[model samples]
Target: MTRLAMMLSAVALLSGCAGRGGDLPLQPASALGRERATPVDATYQLGVGDQIALAVYGEPDLTRTYAINPNGTIEVPLAGTIKAQGMTIDAVSALIRDRLADGYLRNPSVTGSIVTYRPFYILGEVNKPGQYPYQTGMTLEGAVALAGGYTYRAQKNHVFIRPETGGGETKVEATPEMAVRPGDTIRFAERFF
Candidate 1:
């Protein structure tokens, strides 16, 4: 379909976007057409593609950092290996703290932050449509920019957000302020004019 047509048609699909993780909070990056946006739990689950930064208070020896393995685990000094998938960031922090307190270190404090959210896909009408990482609070316009902006044939009037539910309920007036969820499929259509 033409860029304008794709945009116009896709805008009508936002109302139907859904994701796969039934219990997981739906980030804009998650695939669509199955579930609604889920809330982030107090703890963060370590995923395969997730990047993390770890720190310990006053203990560089015990405070090392690493990304979770493709299998959803990480390697540490004393802790050996730990599975982080499905565990909240807080949960991971506490585990580290306890491990350190248990002879690994003296009254160690552990903390971790998610450094990467992984890649989400965008197709149809974007200049470089494909997979892009999910940055916190990123907007539709920013996503488009990452994809190399709209094509000359892009329909500037309406952009559709397909959430994997196979369609959407979003209006034609979606703006840049709208949060770009993970796994969201944005489509730009051709203008009638």
Candidate 2:
């Protein structure tokens, strides 16, 4: 009876341990995704490879698109070259208006918008991960899908993104609604089950 009791107790202990500790807790990097805060949308910063469209009121000749030069400037007719990198659309419009007002046109009304954004990068644990063209209202989930979806062992809920505007990488829980910006690098880590 004592031997049977001992065997039953051993089996109970083993089963309890198995139920309690199936996998080791994820390390700091992996654990980071769970405690996500609401992500704020930062203003879009212009960079090289971005295509911008600008138009001036009643100036058909000046209404066109131009790719940002490697030096962060764009050529404008009669206005010469104007710096555009790191400036918002409104700021660019103001700059153009000021430039055109000089010996060109009085109170030149200008409007500018981004035609194309720089490509985003994705690597690690995703199938066919690489650079992909960025679209408006992109999210982490969307980026993963563009990269051909997650791999078999991808941590679908955990992701890290590095912004091109200069901040370091951030780890956040993957959500379909979180907005992604151009020139961001996304990483879908592997999961250990």
Candidate 3:
């Protein structure tokens, strides 16, 4: 009876170990696809290391491309420094217009666009994992392609991503159309088999 009880206890422990208790929850591939399908606040927020082109109508001197400084501000001639971080393109344009309207221009018609996006990082289980230039509408598959595709032992089903906006790392099933955002860190998981 004692031996049978010990065997049952060992079996129970083994069963508990077999259960996925510590693994990160992974979002289904279709879930990511559905997320991509839904249009949520599609505005792109500016951040440090992003290059922006600002144009002021009828004012050639004030129209130029500017890089967001490390301090998250951009210095405009005559208008001084304006905060651009975490602001949308239109918001930044409006702010610049307001600043220039303050004795700088009669009616500052300003428009802004992103010239270049910040780079994204990829690591683990890829052939060449490192920072790569971010392009608009880039997908995770494209990012993997940029990283020279996955390694032989890479887990092709899912990957972990840490967004640039700051959040806990998410485990998401790998899909071809998953969007990749600027400054995101993507980590490919290795296969256990």
- Superposed by TM-score, candidate 2 places the C-alpha of residue 84 at a distance from the truth, in angstroms, of 0.7
lDDT of 1 by residue, 1-193 (tens): 5999989878877644533223222233223222323333354345666777789888777666577777879887887787887677888888878877888688887888877765567666778988898776667777888999888887665565665324543434445655565446676654433
Report residue 174 deviation for candidate 1 (angstroms): 3.8
Error at 39, model 3, angstroms: 11
The candidate scoring highest on lDDT is: 3
TM-score of 2: 0.74
Q: What is candidate 2's CA lDDT for residue 101?
A: 96
The TM-scores, one per candidate, come to: 0.60, 0.74, 0.83
Ranking by TM-score: 3, 2, 1
Runs of candidate 1 with Cα error greater than 4 angstroms are 1-45, 152-173, 182-193
Model 2 stretches astray by more than 4 angstroms: 1-42
Residue 192 deviation, candidate 1, in Å? 9.3
The C-alpha lDDT values of all candidates are 0.66, 0.77, 0.84
Task: Please list all clashing residue pairs in model 2, or write none if there are none.
Answer: none
lDDT at 110, model 1: 86
Query: What digit string (tens of lDDT, one per residue) describes model 3 on residues 79-175?
Result: 8898999999899999889988999789879998888888999999999999999877788888999999999999888888888889777888888
